[model samples]
Target: MARVNELKRQLKPGQVYRREDLTPYSNAVDRHLAQLVRDGTLQKLAQGLYYFPKKTAFGTPPPNDETLVRSFLKDKRFLLTSPNSYNTLGVGTTQLYNKRVVYNLKRHEEVTLNGKTFFFHKTPYFPKKATPEFLLVDLVNNLDSLAEEREQILKNILAKAKTMNLAKLEHAVDEYGHSKTKKLFRPVLAEMKKTRHAQ
Candidate 1:
């Protein structure tokens, strides 16, 4: 359990981790992995990623994959800016609303761990990939005002929209069209809707 303890000792909120991170402490992985899940010592966000279990006011309910991933990826390269939030908000959005997370990663791989899955989208094509760390940094740089840079964010998103899966994008906007968040996308979404209609 030393490895698990090391992970418990090191990981902070908002950071995403991989198994290679814990390689030095491999001996304790299996026993502790099973034990952690069993006794609530850890919440596995994916095959190699985990987080300290949450203690909610409701006396500790099971955390979803998103929550676990967010808490574990503490202020690092991987941020929790993904469709997880949209999924949690409801079964509506321009994403799969999939139970797992979808991140814009510097790499590409699919991981299934502790019953949770994560898909890492490559970095080269995303113009407005909003991994929360990058988003927060950009937000901070721009007067800490999300409003000040609203147009830029919207435009960047549309520019990169072509890179995403077209069908899923349509389903998301169609299902969640009435949300106020749509207001941010009104201009681009309108244009997209027009183009979609013409086709």
Candidate 2:
């Protein structure tokens, strides 16, 4: 297990490792992994993926749902998104309401991480690249399509654009989505681009 300790030492907190990844380091892979788990050095996040058990300076274990989602994905085509669904639900920017869901445009089921559950929703670009802001607008679009309070949520996001960064927020609507998305996300996206966003 000298090799296992070496491998473990080489990995960072949020990085993921699989059984196959250890073949180069050791011949008896399964036993070494089991020993690490038994020693409390490694934690299995899922069937095949394992991570160091320590928390980063940001204050959490390997990851929450969002961070894990990024590791699980092959590239940028898909993003973990429940915000679009939440936005669609018309929760708006109501104070004292800190409900967060987990899910993405293409994914159907929900995944849980660190005792927190998240829900994924459907989007046109399912199985495709989903930049962060595009995910935001798609989520806002979802809120716009579903809830009775769509406009208010749109306004809330628009009003908070400066805090979230106008350029990046507009990029979500511009880079990955369509003109319709721009029309839908215009109020918020435009307002964010300006110093003071208003009607």
Candidate 3:
């Protein structure tokens, strides 16, 4: 149909869409979407969620987590992070985690999209990007849930904290960190001050 053609033309590969996005093309947009999915022009990720996959020599590229979550949330007010990011801190957390975590004011449950699981947590505050300071605070905040030795994790994080920007780290600890995280950072920061005074 003409409506289908118009809708298809507007869609770009690797972009996700909702039924409402295509509603402007036709009144029976759902029926058209069903047909498109059947014909391989589109792939259904979940209820009312669709993706126009980008084809490569190997196969269709998987949807980006940001795009998928953004589409699902219908808003950009979310932070995408994972436990595996802890590995990047050189804080002795080398274990790879298969799950992704989204920190947002909305959506406090796990959601699966296209066979990938995303754990959403409702938080009042989080940074736009995962900085080293933020990650350190986050690691300690969720330390109990991590699959690493608790004491060793804390020791390594404290050691790593010494090498980071003290001012920014302190600011992050005050802003995004919980009471427990602040308590833990107290002695480490004290040692930093001692080291600074010695210099």
lDDT of 2 by residue, 1-199 (tens): 5788776766676666666666677667788888887887777776555767557576555555555655554233455444433433333533332234433444666655444555544454542445445556665555543534656666665554446666777666665455666786676555555655443
TM-score of each: 0.38, 0.52, 0.93
RMSD value for candidate 1: 13.4
- State the lDDT of candidate 3 residue by residue for 82-156, as single tens digits: 999999998788888999999998899999998999999988788899999999999999999988999988989
Best by TM-score: 3
Off by over 4 Å in 3: none
Clashes of 1: 11
lDDT per model, in order? 0.48, 0.57, 0.91
Could you tell me the TM-score of candidate 2?
Answer: 0.52
lDDT of 1 by residue, 37-108 (tens): 678666666656655545666675555555554434432344344433432322122334344434444546
Query: Model 1, residue 101: what's the lDDT?
Result: 36
Candidate 2 vs 3: which has more lDDT: 3
Give all candidate RMSDs, comma-separated.
13.4, 7.0, 1.5
Residue 191 in candidate 2 has what lDDT? 52
Leading candidate by lDDT? 3
Model 1 local distance difference test score: 0.48
